[model samples]
Target: MDKHFEISLQNRKLLYSVLKDTPKDVLCSIPSGFKNNIWWNIGHTVTVQQGLLYGLSGLPYTMNMEVANKFKKGTVPEEVPTDEEIEAMKGLLFSTVEKAQTDYKAGKFKEYSPYETSAKVTLNTIEEAIIFNGFHEGIHLGTVLALLKAVHHPKAV
Candidate 1:
């Protein structure tokens, strides 16, 4: 496996750990301090990855822009997205990752637009996007963990 995929998988594993035991209430509840609930964070990250990789690669994005805009960085979650929509987003997230693995192995990204890492650094290949995705994933995982801890008390002996 390429190093980018390896890193991306590691980040995915961490996200799985965080999501595995998250209470449904926590997933759906939007606390005053958090921008969105755990579910929204997960969906937004997955949506961004699919859009950047699939959409930029000339493949149709499984997620529509209206849903994407709901969780776009600057947008506030004024209303909660339905459970059905969240489930659909989750399905797309899984399938997109599988498709991306095949696309990367087959060198399908040769024609995609170049992605910049940040304003200061530019990425010229899909490999860079995968690596950047890992970094972005970790950031959201940290936020989820912190929120989980903040909202609930740690177990005591």
Candidate 2:
């Protein structure tokens, strides 16, 4: 569980770096042929992690419903987020995971509703959800990298 928690933290650090290094314009840009922008991918990763680990466990999510609704699965970015919202998302990228770690250590998650992800993987326990979230975060990290490349090299897109 410690290993899983460390990996999740590392993933969040990578995301924080992305948010820090990317210009606001590039982060908000939706490149040609892309359904969402860099910001959406990052927010989606946070939202999905919360849904999978906390929501499914019947625990209250770290984020509010408004934020979860905005970035949850099947929702496209409706508008470019304000600078304040971006800052909030950046803060959440680490804070949510830190809270989850503390809650997990406190044995807050007693049961989890089984769920099968769109990728066809089954998550039957909180531990499984935490580990699977690492894989999920990695996928979004790759998407963010591709989006950054496309933003930098529009001709390639």
Candidate 3:
């Protein structure tokens, strides 16, 4: 579990670096053939982790409903996020993982409602959800990388 948390934190840091380096316009742009942008993918990663871990455990998610609604599965970004909103999302990218680590250590997740992910993996416990989140985040990271490439070279696409 500690390794899981460590890896999650490391991935969040890498994501933060990517967001920092990416231009706001590129981050927000929904390139041709893509459903969402870099910002959406980053926020979605956080939202999914919150939903999978806290929501499944029947606990309130750390992020607000608005964020969850905007980035949750099956949703697309409706508008470009303001700088303030982007900063907030950047904060959440790392903070949520840190808080989850602390909460897990404190045994906050007492119950987990088993869920079968879209990939058909069943998460039967909080520990499983925590580990599964890494795989989920990695998938989104790949999407983010591809989005960045497309956004950086729109002419080529």
Candidate 4:
């Protein structure tokens, strides 16, 4: 296992912990000042990983396009997530990383189209994307923490 996958897996593990430990109501709640909820962040992270890795590699997405697109870039969290959608996101949390690791070991990523992320980082390879994904996940993790605080905050509005 390379370091990138290791880091990515660890990040996913933390997020998975959040999913399992947090109540469903809290997970589904969008803080008063937030644009999206913890649920949206979770789905967004998974969708972004699939898009950046599989989609950019000219391969099919491991997740359902209809569900995944709901969390794609430029999408909002106006509608609350269904239980089915929540379960699907939870299912992908670890499987996507595991499958990506397997695919990478099997040389499934033959080519990559360079993309400049909004953060000004340009990824030219799977390794870079995977590593950058950790950073992306970290940001969302921070957002989740903030959302947690907001949910309990008196000034959440």
Q: Residues 4-99, candidate 1, lDDT per residue (tens digit)?
A: 666665666555554545555666667667777777777667776776677667776656777777765555556655667755665655666777
- What CA root-mean-square deviation does each model show from the true structure? 3.4, 2.5, 2.5, 3.0
Model 4's C-alpha root-mean-square deviation from the true structure amounts to 3.0
Q: How does each model score on lDDT? A: 0.65, 0.89, 0.90, 0.85
- Please state the error at residue 151 of candidate 3 in Å: 1.8
lDDT of 3 at 93: 88
Candidate 3 wrong stretches, greater than 4 Å: 153-157
lDDT of 4 by residue, 1-157 (tens): 4887888888888778777777778888886788888888988899999999999899999888988888899998768667777677778998999999999999999999999999999999987888888889889888988887888833222
lDDT of 3 at 24: 85
Instruction: State residue 124's C-alpha deviation in candidate 1, in Å.
Output: 2.2
Candidate 1 global TM-score: 0.75
lDDT of 2 by residue, 76-114 (tens): 988978889988998999898989999999999999999
Which stretch of 10 consecutive residues in model 3 shows the poorest summed lDDT?
148-157
lDDT of 3 by residue, 31-138 (tens): 899989888999999999999999999999998888789999999988888889888988998889999999999999999999999999999999999999999999
TM-score of candidate 2 on Cα atoms, chains taken together: 0.94
